[model samples]
Target: MREPSMPVRENAAEQLEERQSDRAYSKPVVVLDLLWDLAFVAAATAVLLSSRDEDPSMPLRLWIVGYALQCLLHMVCVCVEYRRRHNQVQGEVMEDGSGSGSGSGRSSSSSS
Candidate 1:
């Protein structure tokens, strides 16, 4: 039987460096992701609430308030997450977004 040749091993530092490029999310992409998440929440709430046959008006009103609150909360969270990333990524000596910083660059405290 013939022996198989060994594959070349990649350097750990090189792999890490290579992975660092373009790691931050784009502004539009992040907004789109949050929008899709919000959309999912809205769709699920609508489907579940609508499935019940009685008193759509009151529940609909309640759902609107709840949905608005949920969307607000989601936006806050996404913004916080992005801000944290911005701070950490900015602190990093490696690459940065340069011309493209997202969501105000408000410099909030980071916890991890």
Candidate 2:
């Protein structure tokens, strides 16, 4: 006779198998995202440099502040994107059903 928890176990196993089969991210997608981030960084740097020679008036100060903010925003965006891509790659690897044993199984079992 099956235990009451058996169906729950089977359902959980099926859900895990489904998650494992999902394809979350691709290498080309990550590469393109990185390239796009690089472009934003380059553009931010250009704006900062171009404003360097401006007169020290209020408008110039504002422009400098704006450029600095842009640079900071771009850096934050790059960091977020990189983290997102890394997470996606990890998810994809887990889902591939390759049984690569990348430590997730151990972690999940430990949590349970």
Candidate 3:
């Protein structure tokens, strides 16, 4: 016997493709993010390799310090990007006259 067809199941692949095509960031930003991720991985690998060395004094300390600085720099960059994006979104919402302050409004309604 033939079962009923599900449109949701059939359109899953199309939906995924559409979402991928509708990226928020540009290609350059995506590429830069990938490069930064690779750099972080390389730095972490260097730190791990340094730990395995018999002489773990100077080289290990330097790698650890460098990794720490990388983490701090990444955090600052993320914070700046987040603030910029947040302000941009707020500006958009303000223009739209929605005036949705935060998630608090949505959460309260959903609970009711």
Candidate 4:
């Protein structure tokens, strides 16, 4: 069987880079998503609590506060992780492009 041609490989690489670039999220948008998620979770919890017989409102209120803090922490951690990985991938792509450009512009593969 013959290996795929260079034009095909370059097309595939371009598609991959486009996909990678598209996957990045704006920080504010991500935070807004997290807030929406928290709203749904909180609404569910409120519904469940309303159906119960317990009367102590203070503890539940405190727990909700703590849960919100935990969610904020989770959002921070998630954003940090995403940014780190995105930067790493972009850096790798830059290094790869530069490295290849510095040599004979031709790729090392025999398909050229």
Candidate 5:
């Protein structure tokens, strides 16, 4: 008795390529992500502990506000990074698509 062979539902080569591209982020971005992680933890800790007015210089309200602002800034940074990488990948894809000179560039422009 023999089992039937099956074709791959997902492309292994594309998955590998995507993984490689994902790992190709610059060192600074990775460092920034780590710093953001630390900042988040610190901000959360500060917000949690500052409910009792541990710091006399700043009020708990100010700490909460600062934490909220930090969260907004983090969101903005994430959005900017995502847009930057998305554009980079789109540009690369466009270049590759246009390599054959089949007027695909015109279609992209017209679609935009």
Candidate 6:
């Protein structure tokens, strides 16, 4: 004999609710991303301004160093943001799972 069917509609509703809750925190993440981009832009501007001066051979070396440093900083920022976003997503999934499990447990205990 087949087992009783699970409440698919209720499960879908719960998932939708969890996704809505997760989206509430998206604004801060977006703001952080924008801030990083702004910082990179500022670094590029500084490099350009400093290199524009006529300082014989030193300015060229300085410009090269500045460009390399800027590239490194930008890469680091991207990696950090990527890791932070990944962690946030994992945390949300864990929280959602725990919430659903506890809710189901409560419902089951109440009916017994």
Number of the top-ranking candidate, with lDDT as the measure: 4
User: Can you write out model 6's per-residue Cα lDDT over 4-88, one digit (the tens) per residue?
Assistant: 3357666667667755654544656655755766676677777677767566755565665576577667656765766675575
On residues 1-112, what C-alpha lDDT tens digit does candidate 1 reach at each position?
2233222233344445434533445467678978887786777677667776775555665666677677778778877877776666566523335635422232222212
Instruction: State the weakest 10-residue window (summed lDDT) of model 2.
Output: 18-27
Ranking by lDDT: 4, 2, 6, 5, 1, 3
> lDDT per prediction?
0.58, 0.61, 0.57, 0.62, 0.60, 0.60
Off by over 4 Å in 1: 1-24, 33-57, 94-112
Model 5 TM-score relative to the real fold: 0.40
RMSD of each predicted structure: 9.8, 7.4, 12.7, 8.0, 11.7, 12.1
Per-residue lDDT of candidate 3, residues 18-100 (tens digit): 34543534445655765776677677777677676567445666666677577657756755765665565566566557766
Residue pairs in collision within model 6? none
Per-candidate TM-score against the hidden true structure: 0.43, 0.38, 0.39, 0.44, 0.40, 0.38
lDDT of model 4 at position 105: 26
Q: Name model 2 segments beyond 4 Å from true.
A: 1-58, 97-112
Q: Judged by TM-score, which candidate is best? A: 4
**Candidate 5 structure quality by residue, lDDT tens digits, 32-76:** 775776688677767676566454665666666677667667757
Tell me the lDDT of candidate 1: 0.58
Query: For candidate 4, which ten residues in a row score worst on lDDT?
Result: 102-111
Candidate 2 residue lDDT tens string, 51-94: 77876546655654576567567656756766775675567577
